[model samples]
Target: MALLVEVHVPLTPTPGLPPGEYPFPWIEQVEDFLVDLEEEGAAESCDEGTTFGDYFVFFLVGATEAGLLAASSRVAALKGVPAGSFALVTDTEAPEMGTGRRVGLPL
Candidate 1:
């Protein structure tokens, strides 16, 4: 199973630092939180990466139900991050197998 977790983080530019500094600390915090959940049998594997922008974005992939739950909990906890802002979303399974279609006109 594959689960995609999207995180949107708000960032404020520092006086001397570059605009949108690395969210390493926030990342570390998230990683640590996820690791703890994994240790508690709440996750299978967690792969995290970042995207650049005025707001930080994080993508996490998990391979199990526990993993998904862990990811969700971690994201929820980030609501209080002192950063500029934050948002999180998780992928859900389709109602039917291979029954969903993309809504768009094929060019």
Candidate 2:
């Protein structure tokens, strides 16, 4: 049962850095953080193969709240990342358990 975790990371442009300068340093930092999670047993694997618009999406599998917190803390320390960026974790195997309400009644 693998979980689909969406980590929304807020990015900031650094001064003196050109638009195409490419912030590889900060990106490497994010990768390291994800790798640590995998090594710590908090995550099964971290997939770095997705791109979300301008920002990259790191798919963190088998994540917990504690693990999320640790990752967020490390990411927050980076210069180009903001403080409020979050890691959204959800079980991919779990179905939507919400109650369905009809919008319109039948005549």
How high is the CA lDDT of each candidate model?
Answer: 0.47, 0.53
Candidate 2 lDDT over 58-105, as tens digits, reads 555665645644554555565655444545555555463111221110
Best by lDDT: 2
RMSD of 1: 9.3
Error of 1 at 63 (Å): 6.0
Clashing pairs in 2: none
lDDT of 1 at 24: 46
Candidate 1 stretches with Cα past 4 Å from truth are 12-24, 63-70, 78-80, 83-107
